[model samples]
Target: MIDTRRLRTLRAVADHRTVTAAAAALHLTPSAVSQQLVALEHEVGHRLLERDGRGVRLTAVGRILLGHTNEVLAQLERAGADIAAYTAGTAGEVKVASFATAIGLVVAPAMDTLRDKEPGIQVRVLDAEGDQSLTMVLDGAVDVAVAVEYRGAPGEDDLRLFRIPLYSEPFDIVLPRDHPLAAVPDHDGEAAPAPERDAEMPPTPEHDARTAPVDTSPASTHDPRALPVDTPPTPERDTRTLPVDTPPTPERDTRTLPVDTPPTSERGTRTLSVADLSGEIWIGPYPGNPCHDVIALACEHAGFTPEFAHSSDDFSAVVALAAAGAGVAMVPRLALRGTDLSGVVIRPVPGPKRRVFAAVRRGAERHPLLIPLLHALQDAATALRQAPSM
Candidate 1:
């Protein structure tokens, strides 16, 4: 193969069309340029130049090599331009893999900033989860993956992995307006179960499923009792024969007034607790879906195993299910944007979240634009984390 430097010399000679001129362009002697060109010709196994008076002219083979060399040189120059632009934080394309939440709450906003400020740099986004995104980055499928890392999650920093700390979103519990709990007090000492009427409750089945209207009324927020179903009294047993050793009881005075009975509290009007919701239907992205971790945590946090009524990967489906009272679901704040789920409520949960990270191939540390993008991501993450509404 021809040495790169020798190729450079040949290209210069071709461009100048004279040994002396080419040597001057390359800061080399005419003899040195001729020698390098000769060496390149030998490596290609053919004569690259034709004899002419004073200087030399390119042969057909020489022209072909020059064509290829020109392309290579152009590519190198483009790469250099990309490098300069990246270092200045103003050019090159950034390939990114982002989770649904990050795409909206973080990536979208960052994209606007990148477009306005660094017009020369283009950004491409792929919607993906943290694990898959990281894998894609490590395999060179993406330049950077916006991954989450919950507290106590694993790490890859020692393997050339880097990360930016992004914002943390607290969970919320969604409830209807007339929910018995709404009538109850909040975390503050104030009384809950805000005084509301049955009209605020979700439309109760006069008993049909499909025609259900928007349940403007909230379910009781506090522990509400289930309406009791009358059970048939057990058949009374007949004891016709008395055993010979049976003892008799003493009789009481016939006319004594019966003690006043204590009045009973209303059972069906109380708020339903988590345990009372065992049979409630639920909705989610999919079975065992990672995005639903917070939903599961919320259910477990609320002291019940969530009864999922339907499953789908589409965010819209989850929202739809929640709208129909199929069951409550956990959704990224970004995914919830612009969606009107009039009856669905957002509730906060404690100690529940997902974690993510930024990943790239093992040897990509030296990539010309990779470093710049990584730094930008880190800075953006810091700003996002410190911003309000996290």
Candidate 2:
């Protein structure tokens, strides 16, 4: 029988394409990784690796073994999950990997809820992006991964994984409060008027016009004429028209737009088009990050390529850079929640959206701890969906 650990080492080398890289990911010494590969070749009775220049390439026999290794590993995962489900207690740790913002938006809140409700189940979280986290889950390094949909992610029908969708959040344009596009035209340098304490401001005609569908194809440029510069002000209706102790109307409690959608602006409020930002420097994620791809694709759709002058994987840092007047940024709504917005104004933009999901190896969905964790995440997502815009 082949050793699973040696098979794992072989798979890691295949994924990373280099012994040194696979060694780093597996937390094994380069010599140890090499030893494992050698031992596995002897067990299999076939040569697996061939040195090409400084790197190694898998032989035809090695590729065949890798295919079986993937199936065997997936089967082992399912077996483990089944065993865990049937076990008496939920006292073990469930390792999780996720992007930075999701730690606050979903995982943290779920952990808080679980603290009192299921103290026996401890959750371990590691900061990782969508693709990396998924890879970790597949490799058994993590039990679950909270990830966002991005290019090259596995499809829904992928038999090797199970996915639970949490939410879909739109990207928002984050700019310095003092930026030319953020100011109300007629108000000059004065701050925009604040909404009344107990009133909901109705959407203006200009807002309606701005929300109209636009061509988002890669070859299209946002038409400047499509943006609304002036709109007639609508009267603010009092939300507290009922008796002091009366229950609020459903309209007052329901959200008509996303929780992070910008509030309706009054007359003379200027809507910005992507073309207007063509010359400004951008702050975004580094090249390997999923958000970086999303931003790049959105820019391509807008008929311009952004000059990314500052890059950070941390959304807070991106926002901070924009707030400091370093450059503008495009960020997911959840990333901005509870962040310091003192020098920034976040506005809605018609662009790409990210769909967040919780992923596990196939057949691990019913693990005892995972069920409660999923409930906690769902509760948090529902609350966040109903929350008012910041």
Candidate 3:
């Protein structure tokens, strides 16, 4: 085998054209350079240099070897530059895998910044779900991967990957503006009364006692025991043109009213079961996808199996489906922000949360640029968490 050390020495000597000069360049004694050259010639079974007086010149075979040596040296220099560029975080490529939700939310935005900041750096994003992303990262198919863990689902704890929190959003029930619940009065941002119910009327008590028509007189002027005792008979009048002593009847509204609550609410001895959504189709990514697993398990725990009505690698497409009423989908909150989803609603699955991490090849940690990239990701994660809309 041709030794790299010997090749380097030979190439150096060829460039400088003298063993003494090559020794000086390599920080070796002249005797040491001569000895290495002899060993190299023995290994190759060919004389690489011929003595020309006190100096040396390349033999015909040595000339050919020198040409090849120059090519090899050039290749090594290029390789070194590539490594240096990668170390400086100014060049090279990174393969990243994540789900559609995160691709739109975290990865895409971060990539935008990276592109603007480092033109030479290339990032390739793959649309992979949670479990798939993890598998890819672990298997060395991807440099970095983002996966989700539900609020309580089992997941990786300790690994070579650098874990970071991207974002967290509260789940909310989505309803159309014309929904009955939409019309319900809101008191301090909270649901008040059902829209179909009659407007509330505070009770107004009637005057319980009334005194007969009497002349105005000072009550203090007359003593109780001395007042006239005889009382006249009650006056009566026609219903239209006269007054009567009878009490007036209260007026009743004649408009028919709808039931305030659903009949299911009024039923007795019934248990509230998970909604029967067998007829409702579910839409999400594939099985190995993190978001897919989250949605599937959430639905399963909720007593229903989700039907994947549409499968797409594009996360935007998944969200569009949910917004279009095609189906419900579990997605990262960041991706859904500022998106105009007409009827889509976001709800939290009563399950575990997906955790995302930064990963690299085991020995690649020593690379200089890795640390900066790691810090950038950490800072980005913090910024994401603090951002209002993320």
Q: Given candidate 2, what's the lDDT at residue 192? A: 53
lDDT of 3 at 3: 74
- The per-model lDDT (C-alpha) reads 0.50, 0.68, 0.48
Give all candidate RMSDs, comma-separated.
Answer: 28.9, 13.1, 33.4
Per-residue lDDT for 1-390 in model 2, tens only? Answer: 899999989988887788998898788999999999999999999999888777888999998998888678766765665578678467778899988877887799999999988999999999997489998987678988888888778766665576665666667677887787766443254545322212212334333312212222342122111211113212333211111222323222211224333344442233355666787899998887877888788788778999999988888898889989999998876576566766676655654677777787765665667767766776666555544433
Candidate 3 versus the native: TM-score? 0.44
Write candidate 3's Cα lDDT for 54-167 as tens digits. Answer: 778999999888777755644453355347745665567777887666566567766776767666667788987556565465344676665665433323232223333333
Shift of residue 61 alpha carbon in model 2, Å: 4.1
Report the Cα lDDT for residue 235, model 1. 29
Off by over 4 Å in 3: 1-91, 108-127, 130-132, 150-279, 307-329, 345-352
What is candidate 2's TM-score against the reference?
A: 0.73
Clash list (residue pairs), candidate 2: none
TM-score of each: 0.48, 0.73, 0.44
Span of 10 residues, lowest total lDDT, candidate 3: 207-216
Candidate 2 error regions (>4 Å): 42-47, 50-54, 57-61, 129-132, 157-160, 183-275, 388-390
